[model samples]
Target chain A: MDGLKKHIEEITPITNEEFDYIKTFFKEKKVKKHQYLLQDGDKVTSEYWIVKGIFRAFHIDKDGKEHILQFALENWWFSDYNAFFSQKESNINIVCMDDAEVLCLTLSGREQLASEFHKMEHFFRMKLTSGYSAQQRRIISLLSNNPKKRYEEFASLYPNIMQKIPKKYIAEYLGVSRETLSRLYSTTSRD
Target chain B: MDGLKKHIEEITPITNEEFDYIKTFFKEKKVKKHQYLLQDGDKVTSEYWIVKGIFRAFHIDKDGKEHILQFALENWWFSDYNAFFSQKESNINIVCMDDAEVLCLTLSGREQLASEFHKMEHFFRMKLTSGYSAQQRRIISLLSNNPKKRYEEFASLYPNIMQKIPKKYIAEYLGVSRETLSRLYSTTSRD
Candidate 1:
């Protein structure tokens, strides 16, 4: 709860009463390693905030190859954002990588919070702006940078993530292959 | 100005007086084919609303290969969005695909409108939500769909874009090669 408090405070000032109101909408849940938080075809009605451990949202292709879209560690929020917001069935699956604790808020609850609190709306808008900005950077990086450079950047930016996730998942996220990633890793080692 | 009126009305109801006030801040410009409205290293201070013709936002890689990010036709708005909101120099280039007419509005002008009009802020939020939703779809499509499916989907969504842009640019946008796109086109024709 301290992490959630700190994150919200960083964006906007929230009164104790306001925080209490907001907190009521979020339900705490514990998930075990290798357990599924969400699976394809399920409706993603809720967004989860990581309080501890790791979780990944991924899509499996026709050939059953998994492409990791996002990895959420402590203090980060994760959801099948498309399905959650659009009220559609999820096309992605979210799996816990480690035993995890999460604070989950339903879409309706979030909307209620936004309508009831102007500052909450501002906080969310700010979050969306920052999310979009980072996504814009990622898109550019994907288009402009080579696989090696992208791998290096990713390692530096999310060092813990790099250590935790499988190499294959990283390759898929970077739009490369396991063989290619291995070659790049060896090339970087030589340097 | 009729185009601007229609565009704003579609987003939110604004009176003629409010429209006129908004109109004063916009500078109308005509761009010749292949000319740039913006380029890499330039500061993106304004967002452009297309009155006529087509525009593309793209980034050129180190190898000087162009990757198309988006296409804007008449009634659509275009900008180096990452640069526009962040007050940063743009890495993306906005090029006119045909002789184009556009009305450009500065960030400050938009901010002023939002401050003065509550409706305008609500309107902007609605637009942002839809834009974010579309972006989420694109990201999911990129990760989940094959190149052929992506091409078909893009064609159906923006048929005009498919007709106007070069195949290579489409290929780059799909993260496919020119050769692969050629193969896909032939296969589709045969079917």
Candidate 2:
């Protein structure tokens, strides 16, 4: 797909022949709103690249409280990467928030592609580099106690995601209460 | 250098010749205890692989509270990766907890090695994969309000680090108070 091409090319340029070959490793899947792409305890065999739609990955604690881990939008990659790489059962669930289409690559296929192509490996490494940086930022954010600062940083960093994701989910992601989020939102809008 | 070779081999096996070539990119640096390897606002130019030391990477907030981002022990990689990869000024500081030796590789050197050898690219990707998963686990721990569970999980996952790091820093890492960490340690030891 053109989206896949654009996404891959954002990190490394590929020949038309290479693109055609790389595309073969991915299979397309579709899901409807409220449907689950992955559930806890399932073997995470594949990592996905979103072609369209929004999805949330979360863990439900023992007390039945949902802790949002991350959200993926179009062109973003998503997976229980811990399970995917270790070939273990997933500890989290990913559900489609909007009707979606995704391209999936199994673990073996991913490894094969990376080994067979240097640029592909470069592309994956660069993507992981960015993902690692984001996680580090998230850790710093979670460590900070100021919810308003967290809200402002989240909005500034992901204005598009802020607009697209529901306020309640955003509140969960920020580890803030709905009332606090609403207040922050009102004040942010005023500023 | 043997440690570096072994570290890379843990992910992907490499020939002696390749390992030698790869080792050339890295330069060794020694740091004394309490010495800052990197400071806030300093340009992050290199990522370090610990040879023989413990180090703490942390951010100091406006209220002058230290929030431990991570700890690096022997054979572990450490960096303000967000700043290192982005080539930006660091927002955090990395200080030696023990007199230590580390191998430092610049961004250009790292990129060159990855491009020059597919195995090196695989090596980097695999390391990032593990790092990303650890960050996800940390995010989950941070979101969970139960300090006992957090301490137990951290101790189980990093027993060596638990022994090597000071209790106060561990408390900061868990986002729990030192008093709570002391109780957890006493309970954990009794158990």
Candidate 3:
């Protein structure tokens, strides 16, 4: 909870009263390693804010091949946002990679805070701005043909995530072959 | 512009006074077809809100192949958002596909309006939410192995843009071969 206050304060200063009210909207939960947080066809309601742990959000194809959409680590937020926002069934699955605790906020709760507090709205807007920017960069990288550049980018932008996530998952996220990733990793180490 | 005012009011209603003040932050510009609104290595300062027209934002690869990132149509906003938000040099290019009119708003102006009016902040936040959701869907489609499914999804989501944009550009955007797109287009039309 103190960390939540610190995180919110990083974007906008919220006093004791505001923090108290805001914190009530979020309920904390513990998650075990390899547990399923969400699954396909589930009605997504709450968006999770990671307090500690790692998780993968992915979509599985008919052939059971998984496509990694994103990874959530400490201080990151994750959910099937489209489902959460529109109150639709989830098309993606989120599974925990490590034992963790997360703070959950329902859509109604999120809206209540935003509508009641102008600063909360600003904070969400700023966060989305950065998220939007990151997606644009990822799209560009996905379109690029340079495998080495892509690997280097992932390593540079998310050193912590890179270290935590396995090479196979990293390759899947980068749209690169496992063999190619291994070669790139060895090459990068030599360099 | 009444269109801009209407667009904003669709989410939140505002008075004549507020609209007048908000409109001043945006400057309208006429764009000619084939004109470059933004180019690689350029400094991005503003995001454009299309009043009328069609445009494609893309990246050029080392092999000199162009990859379409997104298409902007009437009421859509487009820019190298990563650059726009970070005040960095742009790696993407936004070119007008049809003669169009757009309202430009700088980052400073955007922040000013958000701070000055709570409604504006909510409006932008809502816009970003939709934008983020759209990008997530796009990323999923890109990762999917079924080209036909990808083509079908695009056609369904942006039927208007599909009708307006040429087959070549649509093919590039979906990362499918031009020949495959033509076959899909013909198959859909004959249905």
**Which portions of model 1 show Cα errors greater than 4 Å?**
A152-160, A164-168, A175-191, B9-11, B15-25, B115-118, B164-168, B175-191
DockQ ranking from best to worst? 2, 3, 1
Task: Give each candidate's interface RMSD in Å.
Answer: 2.0, 0.9, 0.8
Which model, 1 or 2, shows the larger lDDT? Answer: 2
Better of 2 and 3 by TM-score: 3
Worst 10 residues of 3 chain A by lDDT: A153-162
Q: After TM-score superposition, what is the CA distance of residue B1 in candidate 2 from its true location, in Å?
A: 2.4
- Native contact share for candidate 2: 0.83
Record all residue pairs in model 3 with backbone atoms less than 3 Å apart, i.e. clashing: none
Where is model 3 more than 4 Å wrong at Cα?
Answer: A189-191, B186-191
Model 3: per-residue lDDT, tens digit, A66-183? 9998888888777998788898999999999989999999999989999999999998888889888877777787787678877776776677565788888999888888998989
- DockQ of all candidate complexes: 0.42, 0.83, 0.80
Order the candidate numbers by TM-score, best to worst: 3, 2, 1
Write down the TM-score of every candidate: 0.83, 0.94, 0.96
Residue lDDT tens for model 1, A1-191: 76787788997888887787789999999999999999999988898889998888888877777777767788777788767888889988999989999999998898777657766665666666655665666666666767876777566546757678888777877888799988887887788
Give me the runs in candidate 2 sitting further than 4 Å from their true place: A186-191, B186-191
Error of 2 at B146 (Å): 2.5
Least well predicted 10-residue stretch by lDDT in candidate 2 chain A: A153-162
Q: Which residue pairs in candidate 1 collide?
A: none
